[model samples]
Target: MKRHAVPAGAMLAFFLTLTGWPQCASAATPDGAALSALWGLPFAGVLLSIAVFPLIAPAFWHHHFGKVAAAWALAFLVPFAFFFGANVAFGTLVHALLEEYVPFIVLLTALYTVAGGICVRGNLQGTPRLNTGILALGTLIASIMGTTGAAMLLIRPLLRANGNRQHVVHVVVFFIFLVANAGGSLSPLGDPPLFLGFLQGVSFFWTTVHLALPMLFVCVVLLGGFYALDSYYFYRREEARSRFVESTPDSASFGIDGTVNFVLLAAVIALVLMSGLWKPGVEFDVFGTHVALQNVVRDVALIAVTLLSLVLTPRAARAGNDFNWAPIEEVAKLFAGIFVTIAPVIVILRAGEGGAFAGIVHLVNTPSGEPHDAMYFWATGLLSSFLDNAPTYLVFFNLAGGEAQKLMTTGATTLAAISAGAVFMGANSYIGNAPNFMVKAIAESRGVRMPSFFAYLGWSSAVLLPLFVVTGWLFF
Candidate 1:
């Protein structure tokens, strides 16, 4: 597939401007304490555009989304430069790029590229049982291969299996809810927020031990609900069901092409782990942001893995998967704006009781000045629904007193609540997590008729909100 020139060129320009800028003598970053909540309007504006524009003006949104994103980003940056000085504004932009957006987009691009090359071949009917099995399998692998990797690898086959169905939108929706979000709750490798925790000194298996029950509870409920819903639809579409059955070949069997891509997936995971574990005590400062040697190695190695998959995988496998670059391209451009606009919001959140959002800070603490576990769950989850979950997780992580050992032991409940909230609630919106949008884009490109952004919010609120409430009552 041909690359989209606009986003690629925009990203290149962003990186060059970030790295090539001169640093200020004083390391004056945006002081969250000095900022007001009004500073967050641009971030909120961008998020609203993401939610509203597609439904009201599909053509305009599709054609000019990059420009919209950039406009919102500049809405924040221009004011920020005027108020905070160009040096501080540039520093903030550079920090956001080097430390957050770059690594994020790189990992996503690699996973999307590699997973797109592996196609599942065979004619399979989308029976409730079969669909449930695919969801279960995708959920099981999400933590191992990441939500992005697992979603990209399996979505095409799942779509193909259900191609003959009259009612298939629910299948893709549940896939996003389960495989693309909740499934990633078990390990740091499973979700970006958890991986950020790992980088912040949380143990590799801490989430596995802490969040297993909550994750299992949510998955079981979702899977059971999906089965009942799918079975109902399957019965109603008797004509479509017969067509699917007739098209199926008795001798057809399932097999995976480009199996070698699995090895590259493993390499991707290893590179992530290595970046967290193999710190070489070396660093490079890009503007005011510090770039570590190990992270550099990890990013480079991931790029190499992306190249290797492109070289080794047969073109036929990708063609069968109907792979294209649009999903990744959309993610890279939109999140560039997200990461940029989100900077002030994060700074304000980090400011805690002294910041303009002090009321939010107060809500997460008890009358006794103790961490409120349920509130932590809800607050983190709510913020994570709109903002990127990784930084939201980091905000609550630090708010809960950023001591890894203490959190693992004495503050275990708080940490688990934070982890569960960030990972689970990411399904609440398409833009909550990276994989959610990519999954939606892929499904829509294949004619799945995905729900508009607000409609999806309605789905998650109806389906997932009750589950989260139950989980909080039982565990948090």
Candidate 2:
């Protein structure tokens, strides 16, 4: 489906937001302890479909991925409603749509829209030094303007710089590593999980204070590794490099278009901060879900900011950037299905020892009843690899005691471990974070020939897993 066409999952979400489909007046949240492991199969199916379909049936997947996602969503909802009652099913759907999916897509759309409007006017040759510099600059700004914002703003320019190169996959992969995931470790604005922490009363700068060393360690190692790898490829493909060097002028002046979007970018950041800092103790009920007022305002204003950017940005700027809504549309549709099916899994994890995944949950606590920092790191990291990292972070956060004051003080290391795991390991898969897939799409659109799902897993397993082990041992 095209960007203008709302997929089945998105249509359902929009319908629910405008007019809820409540089967009853009131309904309680699902009791995770009472649910079986079988309830999680649909969620697993959706993830597997994401991983396998494009590899096995590229044409069909490209044309009908949204229908596939909606099918898996119905697989879960149909059975749940048949067994659990319509009211419960409706309540769960409403909660997922209102509380999580809508807000998630809204913020991403705002970031994508605002950043896509800002175009870098000149392209530099993507040498090892230049690529490394762009990656480093992205990493630095990611914590400031958000990983999505930084990634969107820079990916086009980065791709344009390397358009003549034969060996470009590693460049984009390292971009995902630095800009999309690891670089977002230091601040709430950097990633969704950290933002959730801020909403839960974890101090704004707690991650900045606690995670700076670990972030530095990981970024430095990855940047060095990327430089070495890029140098190898650059020398191997020297012919392509020579052709590009001959064609391009050394005096091609660099400038930025759509500079107004930078101010809009700040507005995006301010809206997010305002949502966390300005709490009016007011909420509106949608079906059984209570939507907070500040969040509502934030979301509304974000949509306004998105529209404003579209109006103010020059047509030439977007055209130069090759901007389109496809990446954001794919994320919106796929994640709608993910949030729906992931509900039971989140509830089960929240049930702690009483739930289906009790063994996994128990690993984070020692026999002495204290939290295990390393276990928290790995468990949170591994789960965040597949589940939405924001909610996964919350699960571990609450497991270690949800109090922000306690987690920031006595359990500081534990909190840091959870934060790091949730932020860093999101690079493990295209589905791990929103920007990973968006970056892949944009690179593929530019003919980068990115890796498939399993191949990408191989990359992360080899490179990121070992580094994470070292990080766990050294920091946790």
Candidate 3:
């Protein structure tokens, strides 16, 4: 059966924004208790999620929940190996440092929210860019706006511009590679992995300088080769159509909307930045629950803005663009299916120390067999693509530091690389990240064809792999 296409950018943008919660507290030494608690929640959540799935629905074994639960749990727990590997070193830091993982999650959520609001606003008219131009600039825009935002913003125009052609699936597939993943590597707002790094200490400016080269490399390859392929498809499509009555189909009347949505999108992003930048030395209770002002304010604002956008957006605008709630709901459904089931597995994995599974990364790990984050980046990424990027990101983030003396040097840098890889490439597979499916769902609505899970990955392995290998060399 043909699967759905959702905006990879919108979901990613929403999720990243949700996670971009700022740290309101001053720098305090992290103690193991807080870090332990952060690690334990997913571990426990995964366990509970799994234990209840079969209990709740034993007859539902063949569904996405049952199977994804098992896989999610596995991916969730993989972080513990890093925790355990660094157990000895972490033993000292956990008891001492203030250990703040919340910041990471908040930043991620914030980014996603911003992307979703902007991208989901409306559709665009067709532009006159050639295939190569579209691939290059389109993917670059994908990074800043978000692969979801870029895809959401561009996919329709690209499709409409090529509406006269056939066999356009390959073009969309390659777009998924460049626009979806590789493009969003620069900032935390651009991609989740980089956001984790921002909180962890890699400066936002540094990431751009480091990642720009790799991003350019991939855009070139996808645009260059895919142009050739797209041209062939265009020719064949034209030829096929010519055999019939060569009639031009009706096109969009440059139906552009959503200017306020862009503003709303900006406001949400401002809130995210505010949350990240606003911190207080004070803690509080709101009606009997312990809460940080930063967390409560940011979360509340995000929800409010999201609701307001929906209510305020003209129905005519949405309908004109064929907008509906199904894409978001579908994302919610598939993702919830994943979250409910992967609870236990992540719990188990979130408990260990760094290097717990360092041994598993001997092949294609590191530049020269040295302990490298690139290894963890691709490894965690492979699972992250099929699993949820959140826990996958956390496991690898925790894996970056606190290893034994033998692996101490450059571990932080390696961690950053792994962080980028998992978050970035997790979007490589349809089931890997949430936004990939969003694009599929949306494309289907517009009468565009999307690939199956395995089919999508084939494009990634063939097109994105070489580019990322360069990313490893250039960025890591």
Candidate 4:
């Protein structure tokens, strides 16, 4: 893949905006109530570009996606700076970058770098049982190593196992549904949204205790469905071939290279936990955004961890995994636009009952002023399918009365719905979660004909939407 160069003019303008104004003395943030719905168009534009461009013009999109993302970002920022003062615009940009985007890309970098180093060695048949087993195992570890980590660690092996098979798209689709999204519901360490919840005072084990039943239901249904579907295709292919023989020796034992990465993975998890647990109350204000000491430590430590993995892991291991920086670079650039354009949308949602989208706020409340659990689930979910789930989760978290203790107790069901929705429904679209896109990119790079964006949406709507309905009926 060719790297897109950042234009000199854009870089100059961005820096000028950043240093154009002094920091405000007060901590007052941007008021969503003052903004118009038109502020959200840039966000919609970027999303539309992501959805439509690759399908219509593959070569152009492949070569220029980063530039396109930057263009959309500037579209929002320029107007924002004009309408709202440069001070507000610059502060918002800094907050989005320092507080949200930086940490997000850092953690993803650590997971991707470390996981890419640990190559699974051995060849196996792509039998129905074997493929299903890999999915199950990946799902199991997703919460521990994060959905990104587990997906990076296992996807290559799964693809190689099915290299000789036709009708393998469903395998990768189910992998995204299970391993990349649904599997990370149990722990804050598992998903970005949940980790944000943890940082907001929700206990580490709260998701484990509350979301267990819902996660199990989705996993069991998806796993069973995958087995049956894979079996049907497997037999069909076998009938066509007349005989399906193992391509590699049965005696070739399975093992893992780059075992040191496992320790690095654990260190990544610990650094996350440490940031959440060890609050020194020391913070530096960078352009009006509060940068905490512990968070800075954690981000720095994670960077070191990523560099160590690159140094310690053998070059052969990464080559065997076909690891390249393209996926991470694509994620970083695209999500930078997402994180920026999404600011006004989040603020509007946060303005509940007084902001531009008060209708949405009303939908989640009943006539008696009580919380509607079902609406919370669907609203959080549908938006999460398109927006970044972490901020989407935070939006509903505040809407549900932002008290962690109360949310964990009296508002427990509402919290679960929001959490489950943000985590699980991320599978509803390719861009719903970071790992979903990475997994798709990796599979396609390996020659798997993954579904198109809308086609994948059709799959999720047909398969996952029904399951979600049943879950709402039974649990919510």
Highest TM-score among the candidates is held by which one? 4
Q: Flag the better candidate by lDDT, 1 or 4.
A: 4
Off by over 4 Å in 1: 1-26, 236-243, 246-252, 402-406
TM-score of each: 0.90, 0.90, 0.66, 0.92
Q: Which of candidates 3 and 4 is the stronger one according to TM-score?
A: 4
**Candidate 1 lDDT by residue in tens digits, 1-476:** 23222222244445555776333433467678999999889888887887788879989999899999999999999998888777688778888887878887788788888889899888787888999999999999999988998999899889888876778899999999999999999887788889778766798889999999999999999999999998888886655545656233445587889989989988998888788777667766555577777877988999999999999999889998888887788878888888788788778877878888888778999877799999999999998898768767877887887778899999999999999999999999987888998899889888899988888989999999999999999999
Best by lDDT: 4
Better of 2 and 4 by TM-score: 4
lDDT of 3 by residue, 1-476 (tens): 23233332344334544665112111122233224334444434543443355446645732555355445544533564345432322222221111223343333343344344332222232222354566677567654655555665565556655565556677677666666666776655565555544444454455566556655665676677876776565555456434422222553343445556677667755765675567663444211123446645766776776666666666655554555555444444444334433333333333332322433434434546455566666777775665556556655554443232312234545655565666567657765554565567667666776766566678878776777777776666
Note the Cα lDDT for every prediction shown: 0.85, 0.85, 0.52, 0.86
Backbone clash pairs in model 1 (N, Cα, C under 3 Å; residues 3+ apart or in different chains), count: 0
Instruction: Give the clashing pairs for model 2.
Output: none
TM-score for predicted model 1 compared with the true structure: 0.90
Runs in model 4 lying further than 4 Å from the true structure: 1-28, 240-242, 247-252
- lDDT, model 1: 0.85
Clashing pairs counted in every model? 0, 0, 85, 0
Model 2 TM-score (2 dp): 0.90
Candidate 3: minimum summed lDDT over ten consecutive residues — where? 21-30
lDDT of 4 by residue, 1-476 (tens): 23233222344445655775433322246787887888889888888887788889989999999999999999998988777776678778888888778988899899999999999878688899999999999999999988999999999999888887878899999999999999999988788788778767898889999999999999999999999999999997555256665535456678888889999999998998898778777776665577777888999999999999999998888998999999899889998898788788878877877888778778998877688999999999998887757767877887877789999999999999999999999999997888998999999998988999999999999999999999887778
